[model samples]
Target: MSFERLNQINDYRQLGNTNLYVSPFCLGTMSFGTDWGWGADRAESYRMFSLYVERGGNFIDTANHYTNGTSETFLGEFIGNLRDRLIVGTHYSVFTQRGDANSSEDRLRKMVQSLETSLRRLRTDYIDIYWIHHWVFGTPIEDVMRVLDQVVRSGKILYVGVSNTPAWKIAQGNAIAQLRGWSPFIGVQVEYNLINRMAERDIIPMANDLQMGFVATSPLAGGILTGKYNQLALARQISVSEMLARIDCTTARASLNQEIGRLNLHNLAISLELMEIARQIDRSPAQVALNWLLQQSDITSTILGARTSQQLEENLGSVEFQLDMTQIADVDAINPTDSGMLYGDTVYSEVQDILLESARVVDLNH
Candidate 1:
């Protein structure tokens, strides 16, 4: 479909089974401040925020530890009067105060303290969605679920989500919540992109079976799928020897070189194929990559981050067009998910045939 025929940013979707409606693209505020020396400044951050809100984007994501709390502070100012109209989501379990024993735990005390601090920094009364940034080993799953449920009951949070967690843990925690009459996780956030199909092995399937929303982060694979690094390597004509020599000099350059080196032949092939598809469609590689994630089933929304207004604008254009089935299939063919040991094509087909006993299996969506 043409850009002109694409859906507007305001075409919202229900977050899981909740009553809340949010934009297809979530505005990630990780780069809201330059405390990390690589983020956008306050002025540029506000500009990006204004532009996104003006374009009908209503979902904003932040974390307590992001930019050392500057992200939440900046968002507090940008969202002054519009808080009632937007869905604000923030995470905890990663940030902590010095000398506070319970600060880093997922227990009741830490969750409460963290939410209070986040609320103060965000200049809001209640959070729309609260997430446990990551699983804390040794912490009881029941404790986490119960505290989250308590917060939801107290109106401190409207919904709960989990990020950077395993699929089996998510399933176990949610099942416990259901049995105990506590709040279940309505959404999941994970690293998903063209280069990383790990989530497809379990997370995506789990979310589908549980009827939960899947929020994808790093859909650009840390900018690898953008094809910029490939262009740089080609333009500079840097040989392997020269690349190795430079890696021993500057730390930043060495890091970049390492990241580029980590991109195996499969990754490079996907990047090249994505660029070719973008060229044929007259769109940026980043846009094509984001659109590809958005087109997947069970993907409720993808979080987008930018260091400048220009980058944000380019990313917002991802929803301007839809990839045809052929284009999508071609992309999928290059990065097919790895079927597990018991679920290979032959084994799965035989199992299905024996189970169905000559009955035709129909795909509902088709």
Candidate 2:
């Protein structure tokens, strides 16, 4: 599709009055290289990156630890001088070594230096957004925020976000920053999808209360919701000997649960339903899933990874169309929220009925 054909998808919202404009979907570069076991090569990665930019996508997400830095390397090469057009986010503090000690204050500085190395690899002078990849045991939150503030002040990173940090810790860190008159985190990155709604337990409500931007990663549950796998059919079709030769326990189970559970819930087959939905909407299932996320309130973006240009293209169609209430509720029924918690006050009060009273339906109209 041509760039002109692509909608601008201006689903922008203020991140606590930060004056930052962002789309509701962010392109994830985790599959830029094969270091994490499966990904595209340099050529394919470039193609996907170009396609994403051509589709009016400005935000890009990656990690220093993804593909042993190859993801950043590809992004660096791909972005070139057009870096100003990109709101790139990369992370640190993930478990790099099984037995090594976690990052300390100095270690966090080293990590930021390593991020500079990533900047070199990315061929950019500064990162648009930087993330605390995860909370390690040794680094204090105060120390981490101090470094983040320093980097932001130095113009090394335009915005800072935290990933996988607890709600209370984020609250405390922001409170400290507020008290000290320092820059607090403007965004949060976390695993949020139909299956992994765990962040809704605390993170979503906290972000809502603080007016922080929330970017959801792993929205597909690692391809489970794509309706691409068929464990039952594969098991039935393959002979015992052939199955033994080629069967994968992990992939098969992942496929089976998504397929069977979807069928059981919908009273229809998974692939058929997905294909039907795609046919009716002239979109791919990946697009539908991404649109489901993009339609939610308080969401800044949904990060996506594509090993091929085709996958990226299919996923980008999500921006072209949207899901209505009936469609969203169908998917939501398959993946219900943990509606038991009261979000704003962090109380365990039942607020579903009251909240639903004001719940607006998602659609093209609004």
Candidate 3:
């Protein structure tokens, strides 16, 4: 709130338990291309990339399927000479090959093929971090780990990360890798934000326990946390529901609407509280929301996505200030998951007490 302008971007933080360092925020390139009709053109994308690099941002995230491959191609051009200085991370397991049913398979063959294509598109010899885009139900965890380990051994990818996977599965895979002396996943990417605290129930804790880096995607809740929908609707003199109805029925937009529709009364109340806090602090709602994520101890870095330079600059300002304990508690109080009896802190604490009390008891005979 009313934070002094950051002369530059925040200092680098270690990526998980790895020696590699990345900025406080990773530049997400999902909107780097205009194929989606809602993203930045090549020139605007280049400008955003230049500004981020100029401000000392070195970590950039992109998926092979992002924008039909334009995102990776554009990033390849933008990072020309700076390749050595930046930590380039890209994901796989999403089909980009047209009319290839087998391409969707996350087997060793598909993984290799996908990595090869990503390397060619990015114009790089190796990816700093390679992520499995999502978990495939039929694939064996051992096979995935073995292939990932082989990729690391081949010097094709420096590290492996998993995204959109269940906590127990990742734990099992990593344990297997440890026993086999294979490369374990060093990072985790997941949808994490004020509204989507579901990750906190398991994913976040699992990553912390395993010493894996946690990267939060959709930290803005698909722009809802920015309060843009309400502002845009108000500007057009329409109700929120009416504005949402006017959105194009593209697959991406529909998915976003589905996520927003999940917002119950508690979420709306939290949004209002967030807006009030932003007002009291004299900061933009987006900045306040992002700052809260950056302040989280479990988050190694929060991914920031923007289609324009102004939006990117505003997101960059998030790292400039700290949210005090009072502000954090205020926001925490309205969190959607905090009210649940099964998952709330109250029950967790009680369970911990019971476990600790049981641990302290021992029979003299034993």
Q: Estimate each model's TM-score.
A: 0.85, 0.78, 0.85
Question: Model 2: per-residue lDDT, tens digit, 65-135?
Answer: 78889999899888878777778878863543333333321256566766687688788888877887655
Q: Is candidate 2 or candidate 3 better by TM-score?
A: 3
Which ten residues in a row are the worst by lDDT in model 1? 341-350
> What is the per-residue lDDT of model 3 for residues 1-366, given as tens digits with 9 covering 90 to 100?
122222235577788889888987899999999897679999999989998999889999999889989999999999998999999999985532454434443657788988999999999999999998866544568998999999999999999998877788789999999999999999999888887787777878888899999999988777777876566667899766676677544657546646446433445446667888888988888888888777776788888889898999999887677778788777666574542422222333443233233233233555
Off by over 4 Å in 2: 1-16, 96-106, 231-283, 339-366
1 against 2, candidate with superior TM-score: 1
Going through the candidates in order, what is the number of backbone clashes in each?
Answer: 0, 2, 0
- The local lDDT score (0 to 100) that residue 329 gets in candidate 1 is 74
lDDT of all predictions, in order shown?
A: 0.79, 0.68, 0.78
**Per-residue error (Å), model 1, residue 231:** 1.0
How would you encode candidate 1's per-residue C-alpha lDDT over 1-366 as one tens digit per residue?
A: 112223567888788878888887899999999887678899999999999999999999999888999999999999999999999999985633454444554647777878998999999999999997766543578888988898999998999999877788899999999999999999999878877777777888888889888899878876768877566556779743343454343433236436445444556668878888899989999998888777775678889988789989999998778888788777777677776632122232443333333334355556
The prediction achieving the highest lDDT against the true structure is 1
